[model samples]
Target: MSGAKLVQGNEACVRGALAAGCNFYAGYPITPSSEIAEIMVRRLPDAGGVFIQMEDEIASLATVIGASLAGSKAMTATSGPGFSLMQEHIGFATMAEVPCVIVDVMRGGPSTGLPTSPSQGDIMQARWGTHGDHPAIVLAPSSVGEVFDLTVKAFNLAERFRTPVILIYDEIIGHTRESVVLPDRVDIVDRSRPNGNPSTYQPKAPAANGVPPMVAFGDGYRFHVTGLTHNEHGFPTTDPGDTEALITRIHDKVYDHQDEISAVEEFMLDDAEVAIFAYGIVGRSAREAVLRARRAGMKVGLIRPLTLWPFPYAQVADVAAGIDTLLVAEMNLGQLIGEVERAVAGTTEVIGHLRADGEPITPADLIAALPDPAGART
Candidate 1:
């Protein structure tokens, strides 16, 4: 349990959540993501936390929202299908500004496509699964240690912004084991509480940070929470200005802090003419490919995103500014590659190596897809 113990990525997530002060977990079991819930059930009670296996993913997220409103840090885990079922509540959590975490261990999808195989097919879904326009904070970890690190960060971001945060990784990463040295503790952020008198409290009033200070249900502040467009007083509103303000504020809360929220690993990008843009499990393969390319006297690098939403356009743009060609590799046919293309904006040639056959894109696959280094400089 100490000093570089071997840990599965899914197991590390539970450990990280506990360290981040997660005291409640409610989830239905599903492949790839089931380990997180299974571990939480056994470990939570011992940590003085509560764990509940809801009837399904929808109820699972609903229970987590209820627990979060009660002021406990809450979380849930699911795979592609379960995640699909949670979309409605995901939107509700966004509209209500509920602070919580949802972990999605992705598998080949489009309706139960591959239950036990690895796939990054949920990349776009994680960003836009919920209906309507809403801010999304999604973290994708490529390794066991990063799974732990980002899980803790996910909770912190959720509390800080008072919005749902998602931790997404492919099945391979979830099932893979690696030696990771988890820290004894990590910095924790709790949702800001009401400062003024409870008599005049307005739950949805935006602070300077664009996020309203949250008052838990048991904290004596009576406020409303609804999916309908609401006023600062948290009551239903149809006024044009109120609706616009409500929607815009929720977005600004995250976008205004995107620099803090966005994270990427740029490996050997300097002086490199070619770069690979990848995330999740493919990030590891891309990293190895970069090393192999370098050994072949090719100037190849990698841009592995840790925080996927807000899309890291600025980071990708900077990399594209210098590189001659940016190759995107993912387990899906094409999802994030379009985003990468937008980020590059013709600054560099963009190409993709995509697959959705429930198998990973290996280092050799990426290396083969990469442009000829000898001609890349021309």
Candidate 2:
């Protein structure tokens, strides 16, 4: 605790969760993500927190939601398959406006594809895993250190927005061990608690930021919470006006604050003609490719979205406007590339370098994908 230590990405997540005041963890063991649950079990109680291993992924998420409603910052961790199982509860958390965090350490999958290997196939799933149209905040971290930092940010965002936040890590990052200097102090944000009389409190009353103040159950504040479209008082209502207001508020809470919620790390975009847009582990390789390309006198840059959802359209568009060609590298078969293409909208040529063979994309692979600098026009 005094000096830098070698830590795995999954362990860093537990440390970050503890730093963020996470007091409850409920999860089922799944490969790559199993370490997170193991660490939480060992650490949570020592920090005066609670940890429970539920029967299944679905029950794990449900328990997490229950803990959040009971006034605790709660979380659950899982891999691709478990994530698939928790989709319904994730939507429930969104609809009920529950504040919690979900960590998905991605592995290859379309149904248990590769348990111990890395993949970015869940990029789109993180955005659209749930059934309905709702806002989502998904953060993808590329390094062990980032895994720690972003997990804290995920919890903060969850509390601030009053919704579930996803922290995504691929198998490479989750299992890889690296020396990391843990920060002595980190910024923590707690959910906004209601201040008015309990009897008259409207649990679903919209705040200026489009997030309503939340009160835990048994806080002397009696209120209803249901997945169904509810009114301002937290009751199920079929009223068209009330339904519209609730749904619209949920969407705007994150989308309207896109600038603040979306974070991107841009590498050497100034005067660049070609760009590589990547995330998760692939972004790490893209960083190396940019450095190597620059050393070789090629105007190449990298755009890594630390926040994957809300898609970082504005940032990507700004960078895309100046570049002639953009290459999207990922472990999936062109999931994020489609978003880059949509954001660029023919202003620049968008290409994808994808691999789903349970291997990490390499810098050489990315460099080879770059357009010829001499032949390409800016």
**Highest lDDT model number:** 1
What does candidate 1's lDDT look like per residue over 219-325, in tens digits?
A: 88899989999999999999999999999999999999998899999999998999999998899999999998888888999999999998999889999999899
Task: Quote the lDDT for 33 in model 2.
Answer: 95
Instruction: Count the clashes in each prediction.
Output: 0, 0
- Candidate 2: list runs displaced more than 4 Å: 373-378
Model 2 residue 59 CA deviation in Å: 0.2
Candidate 2, run of 10 with poorest lDDT: 369-378
The residue-by-residue lDDT of candidate 2 on 1-378, one tens digit each, is 458899999999999999999999999999979999999999999999999989999999999999999999999999999999999999999999999999999999889999999999998999999998888899999999999999999999999999999999899999999999978679999899888998899999987888989888889998888999999988999999998998899999989888878889999999899999999898999999999888888999989999999898878999999989999999999888888888998999998899999988999898888988584322
Question: What does the lDDT read for residue 59 in candidate 1?
Answer: 99
After superposing candidate 1, which stretches have Cα over 4 Å from the reference? 373-378
- Give candidate 2's total backbone clashes: 0
In order, the Cα lDDT scores of the candidates are 0.93, 0.93
Alpha carbon deviation, residue 49, candidate 2 (Å): 0.6
